[model samples]
Target: MTSTPSANLFKPLEAGDPAVVGGYRLAAVLGTGGMGKVYLTYTPGGRPIALKVIRPEFSEDLEFRRRFQREVQSAQRVQGLYTAPVIDSDTEGSQPWLATAYVPGPSLGHAVAQHGALPLRSVLLLSVGVAEALHVIHGAGIVHRDLKPANVLLASDGPRVIDFGIARAADTTALTGTGVSVGTPSFMAPEQASAGTVSPATDIFALGQIAAYAAIGSPAYGEGSSHAVLYRIVHEDPDLSRVPAELLPLVTRCLTRDPAGRPSLTEIIELCHEISPVPLRQGEDWLPQAVAGSITERLRLPEPAKTPPPLPTVAPTPTQYAPQQPQTPPPTQFSPQHPAPGGVNPYAPTGFSQAAAPTQSAPGIPGPVPPPGHPMQPTPPPGYATRPTPQPGYHTPPPVVHAPYTGPQQPKKKRTGLIVAASVVGAIVVLGVIGSLLPDGSGKDDESKSPSGGGSSASSTGGGSGDGEASGTDAGKKRPDPKPASYQGIDVTENYLVMLAGDPPRPEEGDPIYGGGDLSYYVDSMFGDTWIGTDNGKFILLNNSQKGSLETCRTETRYTEKITLDQLSAGTEFCVLSDAGHIAVATYKGKGGAKESTYVTFDLTVWRNAEEAKEED
Candidate 1:
């Protein structure tokens, strides 16, 4: 049976209707939930922002309002490169509302539904970004009680964390009322399912589920009724077999049933870095881009159309056979005349014998005897009582009788057909086995291609091949290529630290700093603050707190040349008019960038080389 469509699904709205609350005017409705509506609104300066207002019933509760106010305050303190920052809020207003920087992108749920699960690289990036966000939030003594795919946004830059309404401060006395369960069942941690106090580890558990979903296109625990899902969360192990072998361990750690057993967000960040090392080339950023024409030309192929042939028809064959005739009786009494003594009658010659004789007596023998030539009838004996005679031309076959005898008989043609069918199937199976054992020889082009140029020999190396050998030529004795000489020395410039690495002749002794290519890399501390950047237009601000390391960075918005950062210095923020009649800002801090100055930006193509030497545990 079809399900009833949800009332919130694609509801219409009239133009010019005031969808706003307080000072923020809602340009469009972004989403809705059990609590309230989220609108895509604008700030006074026309900067796009997401505005969330409480439901009218919840707004009247002073305690809820106070709790929400504290949540907003705590959310505002979250500092990272992967979280949206709270731009403004008015808890004291008649209709309380909170506005955050609008991150234009699809929700993780929407993205996964539309495009299937993300690639391994993208999943890695998402996990790292979300974990970093959680780390920042937890460091500020806040626990995001509701961490699900719906609250995660996949912006062009990377994944951004959102939804802080139900978040709780670690030291606050405020708690959700009894019987009010929060969080999506599929993404909740064991403690959260049991309605126990949530911690940063809870968010980590939720992130693990989200990662599993992103990797396998479904939740690891599977989907069903909410109660069933919650029970599985508490009592069952997730199906992590579909997860990439390289990431299974990390995901398993995050999904440990015991909250205390789960890895910390700090550990998650390190794992992400290890699994998905940042590439060296800036052009290899995760952002989607159209392939070059030449590349597409090389990969494109035309499909051939197939058509079925007409079926043949067969005609039915006719057979010729003679019908049997009944024997006639003698003229005197119109009855079967007994053979002289033991001699058989002339009509019952050869195959027809006494066994074929009818049991009935002489026909038409009565007081009014019928003449001969009339149809034959049975007559009773004088001493015995007479019975009514049966009508002529009506005959009944005698009951079948069997004699016990043992002898072999030829099998039927139908049985032969079945044997032929079974033999054909067996032949097909044997041929298939033989084919699999033999070498595939349609052509070299039809053969499987390996990452290495050599054919798939037993000793062949590299990926995309069937051979079970290492990719490197000197697999047994090879060491990693050394970090470039250019990257060895450090150069500090205004707002940057440049490390230039030169090419090496062979492998390096220790872990290489930058082996992929010759590029200027920098890590420097200015006024007791560390910053890393490339000579190219990329930078990462590193902030160390008692909790962990936080990284933030910013890049210009495409088409408008607006420099968007994690946080902008007050006097440095300004707007410029674009040539295309668009208003562009000189610099604007990203949610994470504005809150904390930790940023990371670099060429990601170098990762391909690093991945070659990496081993899965």
Candidate 2:
């Protein structure tokens, strides 16, 4: 999938994220929310799962952790065709996390936003599936207080309910202080809106809102400020005019201010079945074409990279020695070995017994007699005398030298001690050079690069011995770090930490501070005004915009001299293509600088260039 399209859906894992949670290895970050982040992981059996880790701020709460543990136990008992079942969880661990069977599909909210409202028939089918899920949930004494379009995933089989019971666990926490409700404002029941009491009926009210959302493109209470919507929900009647006539009556009953007046899940399911032509189980064609395509793409996610294989083990072989013959000399005792000059290891059998050198007799001289325990000495050939045994404290006479004989000779074993020693030394030297040349690959090139410039000094070393090879590698050792695709909420100044575009589009003084090149963006007027300019690229200012608009730089042409700090009070965001050719986003984030007294600040996030990103992918 393209990063631009699913940019909001999936993200690469960030630093400090645990690679393994419990026993499941995290594959990627699914999405983040106010509570915590959800990740895509797999079970030991290779089944895909969605793991939701509780944020540290909440996990630190002893009360929240205890309630969370109870909720997890209850949620596990909820088994239904239309619910994403909880498969595993760890509530007592350092970081509590819950894992559920992954549902591969777009959420109801995303589907409605991407492909308008669902048709009448599809809405009925969705109602039936969601009602059945709620019936199962309530039967287990669990209430999905937080049920909305975002929590319902439209799977190929049917709609699947998620995030059940998690809201109830947080119901008594600091999040629900006094008048605050645990559920969403747009779909909360009247009682929940006022924080009086919450029950299974609250979910029925949310169910009505979800159906209306699917049939109509927007929430029934209408979208705006949360307080206004909650007030309307509590006192005012819902606007079901846009809702189809067939779904209007049920939606109205479910949205009743009095939860006692709402119909039970069974009745809702029966009513939906009366309208649906096909059984809810046969929902192969339930979703719209556009939504189905997105679901298919999610189901076809590529497998995660596999781990490296373990090292091999060598089995010992049995040692076998040829039977010693009478003519062969006996083996000698092992002696202490000295290393060769240049610190090389001398030739020595790794596991085998050492053999002794054979004795060679002089041409015409008689051979020395054996020790007393040996067999009788051999008779001297013809009239030659046998060597006499040496007396105590007396040394034996040396054998006499003679002229060389011209005759056939036996082959002698080749001496390979020196050759083996040289080979071992060369291998060690090569490994050392290779290790020195290997790049650290940490991607901190901008700070780690040699201050003298590039690697001119290092590369000047000529190649010959091991040192030359190591020096030659230094030139490439300063590999440019991966250019940052984007930065977030970085505080920058004009002189010290000016915004610059390069490998990392972070807040740092570069050409702008050195009086060399133009600045991408700089603070001025003592936190009152900000200047915007690029060396060769363009910038587009959004008067009243959301952060999402900064995802891509607009193609239309326009430029403003500067934006006053007061004009950006409505969260104005600007998109600029840096001279480095990467798209960057900047948002006014109040007046305060890192070091300067009262300077303008902008939260910046830069993305890699489209072509460069594609090439790297």
Candidate 3:
């Protein structure tokens, strides 16, 4: 019986499936992949785990078994934040199996297929995570050989690179001798495509392809027959025209034809960090809102079913029992006087049939039934604790304990506190008069407070209200409303305009595109309609009758849907809340001639909550 929102992701166990492996009971089938079938299981302490059992055909081969064992060992040593490390494995057994930490999220391939390409910021964050995973894998003297979208799982916080060492185990298998390519064709490096030596650089090339695939909802190298795609990978340049401009240079560098020319993992991480300076934490919000919600749904896996109760030793004998009343008995109400042992009902419906039961006492047995409410009762068992008899229609009440009470004590006499209060008040008044007559002991005027100069207070505090005061604002006046970061007359066209990084307002571009992909908004011209939306942020059109101010944008709730240009007017204003927690109000300025071009313009003013900005600092 499935009970969770994500229970549909798992399939019921088949008749032939092993109930237990390595002492862990299998709960459900996660899915089958190229390597093996994955099952949802739990450790002895009930921590959820993903158990991968190798296919029988692969486990039968002596060479495959040897390689699998070695790879499992190396994979066990790999401990990285972005990787699902091997928890347990048994390569010597008839059915080789390994368990890893179960990350609850859809695969990157599924996410992209369901929700187009990720925003530029999400892609950059993904690159950093995958690069970090590769760094750890390579440091353990293992080449991932296959690094593609399907191998990466999108968790709520970040990307988790799984199946790290499985590909290397299958690298020298007999299948390769049959002219079968070891890795995915579209994501393969030039060297790997041509059957050349594979190294850490090969994984780097694949990482670049994955990044490009994530930026655009397709492979870097266009899809085709295996041979055709492989040929293009080895001989032709990738179709990077649709890749986000900020990620273009980095992708190009990693996809370098020559293995030696490809940048190292450290360099790749550095490139991503340069593009997005903030360090990506393990549980940071990096995925698009829609994708993040999908991950959250996957995390709601059903709780494991309770262990089945042991079969009864002898069937119950009822005076007027009916034999044709179905093999299972009706559900019974359990009470404190007669509880189910191990929390399992012996006669409850179960998957296993009664015919398979052995004729002997089983560990799990329902406790003795309670006697009907009557004056006479049967004797209790030796070890059973005795309980008070419950009434015919009511449960026995719990025992109540009473506190000891002493005799009533005499009331204390009420104090005349008015006299005491008057005395204290008179003393405070006398001290105040004395303090007024005291001299300016320091001999320095109150105006000479800070030695650094007249603007010392302003200089010490730096930005915000300090800057306002330093700019000749009256001290008695309230600190002026915070000035928002603004950018004007931004032309948003086919290419995404990263509102977070635009000052003079230009398309996402830079020298080698090192630090640009901070996406905030984009213009989509699909189905002959121009729409304004975001892939990494939230957007809500407030109204078309009047323009919205910064305060309105900050307070308004934003939705994750696009607004058509027709719904917008010269006076229309909407709110954009980026994934990075920066909120901005974008007022529609104008658009290119409807027939001449497909572009819209907006004047955007960005603001970060003072608390958020201070935390970043």
Top TM-score: which candidate number? 3
lDDT ranking from best candidate downward: 3, 2, 1
Residue range with the least summed lDDT across 10 consecutive positions in model 3: 509-518
Clashes of 3: 0
True-structure Cα RMSD, model 2:
27.3
Q: If scored against the real structure, what TM-score would every candidate get?
A: 0.43, 0.49, 0.50
In Å, residue 504's CA in model 1 sits off its true spot by: 86
Worst 10 residues of 2 by lDDT: 332-341
1 or 3, greater by lDDT: 3
- Model 3's lDDT to the true fold? 0.67
Badly placed stretches (over 4 Å) of model 3 are 5-7, 177-182, 277-284, 308-617
Cα error of candidate 1 at position 165, Å: 5.6
Candidate 1: tens digits of C-alpha lDDT, residues 384-416: 244455455334323349977778787755788
